[model samples]
Target: MQNPTAATLYSQKQIPIGLKNTIDKTLSEYLKDEKLASYNIDNLKQIIEDSKINFNIKTIKWDEDGSEKSTSAEVASILGMILTFIIYMFIIMYGGMVMQGVMEEKTNRIIEVMISSVKPFDLMMGKIIGIGFVGLTQVFLWGILTTVLVSGSLFFFGGNTSPEDMVAAQMAAQGVNNVAAGSSDISIQVQEIINSINFGMIGTSFVLYFIGGYLLYAALFAAIGSALEQQEDAQQFMTPIMLLMAFSLYAGIYSMNNPDGPLAFWCSMIPFTSPIVMMVRLPFDIPVWELALSFALLFATALLIIWFSAKIYRVGILMYGKKPSIKEMIKWVKYK
Candidate 1:
């Protein structure tokens, strides 16, 4: 009973079938030995202890200084991915809101009265900017509230160890030493990863991507809304935009796994996909010029989209009951 293996197994409420079989086979083989046939349980325990092998593993991480270093790059990657997805969802949700608002206003003939004073382009820009501000405010509040809640929880519950460590400690207390030990190692690794992140840089990048991504898409959504006479008719125009956004989301996911891959590099540079893809790459060692170029392209593309969408919006806002085809839409762009 004092045998470590036996004691550990006995402590469990239910031994796994495979483990029980292993114990049975090991004891049977030990007893089959002619030298151990007459030995009692205590002597057999000693033999088992003497025959046991212990494996100890140590990991070393090296830095540029030839010294050992621990990094949180994985942690930063995870956080970056989470922020990327959040930004993706925010843009889509807010962009849709803009579209629906425009559709509702046009449906109620409210845009007619408003446009009498405000030019069509001004009205469209105002709607896009106003909704963008609302989205930013919501995200800002959410960030603040999440930070406060996490800080408060940590302050009250002890911030020294992470949640994994707490669970490991509980497991150790309950006699699951092996499980607890494994979890403790994982907890240490997680802490190291968390320590390596640059939250300031990530926060700044997230804000820029979030805004840039939203503006680019919202303009198109507004144009779609204006071109449609009814909310249901917006589907035809919405499909391509939605598909593009979906592709960006998938690209962002792919970039998380291969941040430096060619797919990520090109996608991150592209204006349509840059918002999500660049965010996924930002936590890593991306070059400043590439980031700047992406931003420049995104802003430039947004301006171009707004200019083009404004023309469509100006012509379509007054046209009701007829859903414009692609050819007709192109002609609308040529209108003075």
Candidate 2:
């Protein structure tokens, strides 16, 4: 029965419907046989009874046009959260690669030759841009490949036909009306959720935030890489940056239940965490002003950071042996 054949399925005038499910039986037996510190039959019975009790409940929501709402925002929130995590990882992973690439070139004395002809700012930017394209290409390939694979699999396995529907179909073909209610409601709800998404807005915002976030962090990583004499010294500078990104990630997750909360609002506006946090709020349709301001701050901060980091890159790219301190980097920014 675990892997029923076509003949077995066709032979059935009646299809079984979960009365003697072996998996549930096995799980129940395991729970009953298990020993636990918190095991109490009386308490367990009370919990089971409580779970069976149902209260009369009704939910009413209206759309912008005053029509009653049936779509679930929970799905949108989950999708937004997933996108936020991807942005977080994309920035950190590619930004770290930028730093490592700079460290490698400088360590091998290749920077000296490259710098003889090219300005430090141009060289630094070229490296960042090159690595950024590579990251973009990788993501594009993954998106294409995943969509193809999923579509192919769905086609191969009978697209959109649930097992219950298949069984019911077979029975119906044999002149039997034993088919119970199919999960067509679930499918309709899924379709509604898909239709509810504003892809134009979300897609454009995702790309904008993605680019701005990467540029801001990659510039910081480039400066840190240029300033460090040894790769082992990265921790002293990277600790705070890592903590900031981590906090942004956590803020995004926490915002799922309350996207309009004060924490989410501030994090979305602050350039340091906006890229990650704003993603979680995008699906919720946050105000236009909030979105515009967050985007503005992100790009503005990225440009300013690039200008200052370029100054450090100029000085540190040439100096060798001595490790530059925070004070030295600050002074490097002021160098003519």
Candidate 3:
């Protein structure tokens, strides 16, 4: 028996004990015939005797283990990946502001005067954080806009892109489309993939990796901004960091195309590459150990980069009117 759909706001006194007992009895009667049902008349009897089911809040909260399938995880994972990509692109796209701000200060000769008043490190930190906050504000706006658009699209369109389409594309690419056509095995494969995407893990991991990746890249960008006197001067130094990010992105994408392949496995394990790789793997099955190891490595790497960047930033801010070469960067990196 289904409960009434209408909302009934009942007060604490004069509780509907009789009505509640009748409902419980009905549920017990219905469940008793189903041998598969774990709940029985005894449980219902207790509720009826107690005149309140409130004591079993913990039981009510308990759910079947591993009940969540991979489809939800996959969506969460993809959403995270998309969100991370957008944020990453935005940071890289506008990171020039940090460089430009520094250059502007130097060009106006204001930096020299400011140095008289404040330490170079303080000025550099202030400029980096200030410009970073601006970038963050822009990104926050973009996130809100993107969220609205995606919600609208899914609601209106039912988000029709299904695993079948991806599977078909894969089959067609492999020249197995004709063979997979009208095959029950293809159905099973599709179902397995659908089940493997764990939305919960994907969502959690996406949020973590996205924030972590942004902070990691932003710190590096800030360092680059400090190292260069002008926007143009940043190119030589920025290239390596840019390449690292680009390569990591491509590797993650390529891994998504072949999730179980060696490339995906290796790339996902690498700290620098895991954010993307793990995102792609979220739609598939990844080991717990791999995720843990990747996170540890990335965290350690981020700390090291921050320390190194801060050191370079301290020196580069005061050195003006000269272009920095890779050779000079080696010296900065080597400074004890």
- Judged by TM-score, which candidate is best? 2
lDDT of 1: 0.80
Q: Model 1: number of clashes? A: 1
Model 1 error, position 148 (Å): 3.2
The deviation in Å at residue 90 for candidate 3 is 3.0
Better of 1 and 3 by TM-score: 1
The residue ranges of model 2 lying beyond 4 angstroms of the native Cα positions read 1-51, 54-63, 67-69, 145-181
Mark the 10 consecutive residues where model 1 has the least summed lDDT.
1-10
lDDT score, candidate 2, position 221:
97
Superposing every Cα of model 3 onto the true structure, what RMSD results?
A: 21.6
Off by over 4 Å in 3: 1-81, 113-201, 333-336
What does candidate 2's lDDT look like per residue over 1-336, in tens digits? Answer: 232222222434554557335545665555554532146465675576578966744333467899654456676788779889899999999999999999988899999999999999999999999999987887667667755874665555445775456555655654443333233343433444444566668867887898899999999999999988688998988998999999999999998888999999999999999999999999887989999999999999999999989999999877889887888899999999
Rank candidates by TM-score, best first. Answer: 2, 1, 3
Each model's TM-score, in the order given? 0.71, 0.74, 0.56
- Ten contiguous residues minimizing lDDT sum, candidate 2: 1-10
lDDT of each: 0.80, 0.80, 0.62
